[model samples]
Every structure is written in C-alpha cells, then in structure tokens.
Target: MSVISAIFVVLITILMPPAGVFAISGCSVDFFVNICLTLLGYLPGHIHAFYLEYVYYDRKEQNRLGRFAARPAPGVYSDRIQSGGQGYGTIVEDPLVQSEEGRAGATGQ
Candidate 1:
C-alpha cells in the first residue's frame, strides 16, 4: 500500500470502526458500506465512495510511463509499457499455482 493509503486507513480507523475494517482488509468502502446499509435498510455514514476505475487507470498509467523511463534487463520484461526491455517483451506473466498432486508429479499441471 502507498503511504497516502496507509494514512487514509489510519484516519478511517480513528473515525469509524467499520471503515477501519474495510481499509485494513484492503476492500473498497463502497461494497462494504453498501452491504451494511442494505441489510440495515437505512442510509449509512458520509464516507466517500471508492472509485475502482479511476484508481486502477491512474496506477496503470503511472506504471506504463515508468516502463519507458526505466530500462529493463534483457530477456526480462517489467510489464510496464514505458520502461521495459524488448528481450523479455517487457512483460512478465504471473505463474499459476499448482495443486499438491501436480507438484508431486514430474508432468506439468
């Protein structure tokens, strides 16, 4: 989490227990509060709603810009469009998890 996010969580904890729960769990306030209010059938607190799209897009843009500004090693892509290397295609795919049985066998899952 970013420093600003951490500070925000701290502030939430100081103000509202439910908000603190959402922040600490790394969940969006919208979903959490929505469920709570729905169950109670009443309006909830005045906390700001989370904007997933805005946050996601902003972060993605930052990483994309970082790619070009930062040089990546050969054969290894950073997944950032701006500063990655051509050797690795500048992107690294996350590995899939294997089941216990698959891990024990020589054949790939």
Candidate 2:
C-alpha cells in the first residue's frame, strides 16, 4: 500500500475498525473477525485491524511458513546450502544400503 492509502486506512481504522480491515483485506476471514470484534468492542476491533493491516499484512500472500518450504512457482530448484545443485531436492542413496545389496547379490539370494 502507498503512503496516502496507508494513512487513509489508519484514519479509517481509528474511526471504524471493521471498515478499515475490509479496505485492506477483501471479504476474508480477517474482515469477518473485525466485524465480530467491532460488535464486541471498538478497542478490540481497532487493535485486531491494526495488527492485520500493518504488522501481519503478508503482501505476497504466499506461504506463512519459512523459506525452507517448497517454491510455489515452478522453476529450477536451487538448493545451494545443502545439496549445492540446481535440481529438485533429491535424496542421496545410503552407502551402507548399497554395500548390503552388493553382498546379498554375491550370495545369489
């Protein structure tokens, strides 16, 4: 949101908390919650609206989880930290398992 829009939202929030939340978010859960809270008390509604609009705005609207999560958009998986390659998170086969299989094959079992 731009500076003017932000200021307008804040002013609306002060005057009518539910309206402010509706402006920030659409007919979402937050908007409904704001309505309920406003009915309950102006202070509670105002507080909740402020927290939603400014603090927890979540501009991207993507995963709330941290960066380790899978990419939402399709692209070359770049896991430079761990595997250090541009590919999907492929699991490395265990050396012990490979050795066990080789021994079993030698016995023809």
- How does candidate 1 score on lDDT? 0.40
Maximum-lDDT candidate = 2
User: What are the per-residue Cα lDDT tens digits for candidate 2 across 1-109?
Assistant: 4567778988999999988877766566667878888999988898888776654233222223322224322221212211211224666566899999999999999
Model 2 reaches what TM-score against the true structure?
0.51
Question: Candidate 1: lDDT of 44?
Answer: 42
lDDT of each: 0.40, 0.61
TM per candidate comes to 0.25, 0.51
Off by over 4 Å in 2: 56-109
User: What lDDT tens digits, residue by residue, belong to model 1 across residues 1-109?
Assistant: 4557646755664455446444433344444653465356422432222222223334445565653223433321113211211223444543453455556686663
Question: Which residue pairs of candidate 1 clash?
Answer: 67-82, 67-83, 68-82, 68-83, 77-90, 77-91
